[model samples]
Target: MRDVLGKLGAFAGALLAVAGVIAVASFVIGLLSGRVSFGGLLVAVVGAALIAGVARLGKVPSLLGGYSALVYLGLFLPIVIVVIYAFNSGRYVTVWGGFSTASFSRALHDDAITSSILRSFRIGLTTSIVSTLLGTAAALALARARAGVRTPAEVVILLTVVVPEVVIAIATLIFFVNVGFELGTTTMFLGHCVFNVSLVTLIVRARFLSMGDSLEEASRDLGAGPISTFWQVTLPRLAPAILAGGLLAFTFSFDDVVISNFTSGAGHETWPLHILSALRFGLTPTLNAAATLMIGVTLVGLALAALALRIGSRQGAADFSTSTT
Candidate 1:
């Protein structure tokens, strides 16, 4: 009993000693030469110490899990902030003078912003549709083609997908400059399409591989033509995956900044471009509100899609079983 008590006491004392040292160090550094505010430095030191303790524990505790939850929140929090601030009567990003809908009313009335938003939506839709169609077709072709041909095509597609966006953006810029092509929405559209194709192909290929060939064969036995079988049999099965993949592609195009930064033609501003330009002026809760709204929209879309897919899948399985038995 004595031995156990001594060991516990010593461990506790050592831990306290280490914590005290950390507290003292934090104070000294925070007060040093006015490089950092005392409050800010204290926050930083405490944050580091907490992170170090978590690392030393060698496992994710409930507290750590809560921290992980913060990632999801952080991704979305800004959007909520943006939406709320959009309605703020304040014209500027800062100084929330009063709660008013003047900003939203102003935003709605701004023809330029509205037009840009519409153009962005159009680009996203077109990109998603084009990328998904081409990608799914390529995936199907790869699955059915001779190994030699498929191998080369797959390699090309994989390379296109894996290449860094910066490289693609720079290359696009160079080509446009060389060709004397005026930057416009078209360039942005083409740039997005190029990147999206690879993403779409990978997603569709996974679905294709997982879906064995037997079902298609069975459809052929039922007197369905190749085209009919594809539309009726193959397509229905792939629809969920296609929609999911397309949504992913759309979301990507909607949020893309790096590619847009280089490809978007002058005078044709996008939401992201506007945001980037605005940041140079100053940071404000206005951005935060916009971010919050975007997060909400994305979550709502994903949730609706997931629910629809669940329902469709359950119905599909039931129908398949009934037909088989």
Candidate 2:
């Protein structure tokens, strides 16, 4: 009887969730179609309430189901707003004069904007790859090193995160000047690498620490060479963390304004820099379109990274627990 009740409660919750999703989808569709109504929103709210009530019946603790619904809505609301505004046919960014694709068309056709976007992409991709490699190696080295050596290295790695980004930018600028190097995409790539490497290191290090050394040691004991063990055993386990860190680095590089400002040369503006410059003259619908695209890309990258980390960390924990048992 208890099992049947629990199953029924969960099924009821699932049905409510489906209804809420349908209602939300209808509301979004209404926005795009210029037919937004209060009815869809009311249905969504009622569905959410029913879902939460069902969750309570199913033994979920602390109103977690309700909190989860709210949290997801909060996170996605801004994106939806930006997307809706991106299609605005107005000269101003925020005003909803009408629905049109002119903003996207204008943004896509602008050579300066497109070029800056391409440059940012190149810098971001290169930085992500290089930083991930360097950071992952450093993390592995630290994990395998003696405590005395690891302590100082860990401190150095963390200092970049603790220091102000402007300080790092200034230092990078001065260093480049001292070395007689010109500021450009190369300089921007290098500057981004400095910060991103630290970020990757932190993420990969946590993954490494959680994974522990048991599997690696076992591989070696079973007559595998260190290179082989790392390639076959360690790399596979670390793949998700590396990918997550790389995506994070790419996102950071793409969104950067302050550091890129110091490192970018004359006539070599990144997308963020371009957007900032445009904002000086007040925001436009075209700018909103560009920003909306950027936000979409960034959110996708972050979502993927978060999913990778979550899955990888959970799998690692399960493996470790099973091994110990």
Candidate 3:
């Protein structure tokens, strides 16, 4: 009976996938002809959902792959559009003129854009540094702390990350205003640090927990002092996690718009804020170029962070194996 049901579900999933592909193709063709195909889009969406449901029920790998591809297309299509349009020679963002790098050149030469980009970079760098230092210290303390103390600390850290950014932005704004602190780069820096510190702490703590204390214990047993053991043993092993956390913090800080909007004072527009302001008039290919550049930087940061974490994990495994031997 189970085999019969699975076969039936797989057949249904296959039919739905075929329908979805046809609908999607029709929608794309309509889009290219400047026609809105809501019916086709609706059909595609419904088909995709049905196929996914059937795949889940039947354990059909092909159906699941089809659904995942559709989902990825929806998510990345806009990014693809933006990147393609960055090379557009036309003044407007949506219209396709001939392909050229003029937009990038213009964006680079624009003083306001350049200044905003630099300001964001500076803020992100500062935020990452502060967050990494404070977070690493907190993680170390938590590792040694009693459960009663560590539990609350962990909850607070998680709250900082999980709380709505809009709420954090509004609250930070209110606090700064109430205290008579001027909103500008300083406030933005501080606001970014508030949450970024939590991100770093969580990452470092996870790495530290997985690392265990065997190496540190061995160092201590070898007649090394507390500080010596930390510098020679713990610090070296913790470095990759620290670097990963810092990169992640920097990416978040650079991409932050909600917190930056609330905290940035007059004349201190970050790159995102600058883009927002430019939207009042109209979007240009230059903005697309700027966005593409930002996207590239963000991707690079995230990639580096992942690489660092991977390296750290391997190092930890090697260290553990050696210690055991």
**TM-score top scorer:** 3
Residues 62-124 of candidate 1: C-alpha lDDT, one tens digit per residue? 334444455566787775566766656665665565676555444556666566667777888
The C-alpha lDDT values of all candidates are 0.74, 0.84, 0.86
User: Which segments of candidate 3 are over 4 A away from where they belong?
Assistant: 1-59, 298-325
**Candidate that would win on lDDT:** 3
TM-scores, all candidates, are 0.74, 0.72, 0.78
Candidate 3, residue 284: the lDDT equals 84
lDDT of 3 by residue, 192-211 (tens): 99898998888898899999
True-structure RMSD, every candidate: 7.5, 10.5, 7.6
Clashes of each: 14, 0, 0
Off by over 4 Å in 1: 1-64, 70-76, 87-96, 144-146, 221-225, 283-296
lDDT of 2 by residue, 255-306 (tens): 8998999989798999999988888998788888888877777779678867
Error of 1 at 112 (Å): 2.2
Candidates sorted by TM-score, descending order?
3, 1, 2
Cα error, candidate 1, residue 144 (Å): 4.8
Query: Model 2 lDDT vs. the true structure?
Result: 0.84
Q: List the residue pairs that clash in candidate 3.
A: none
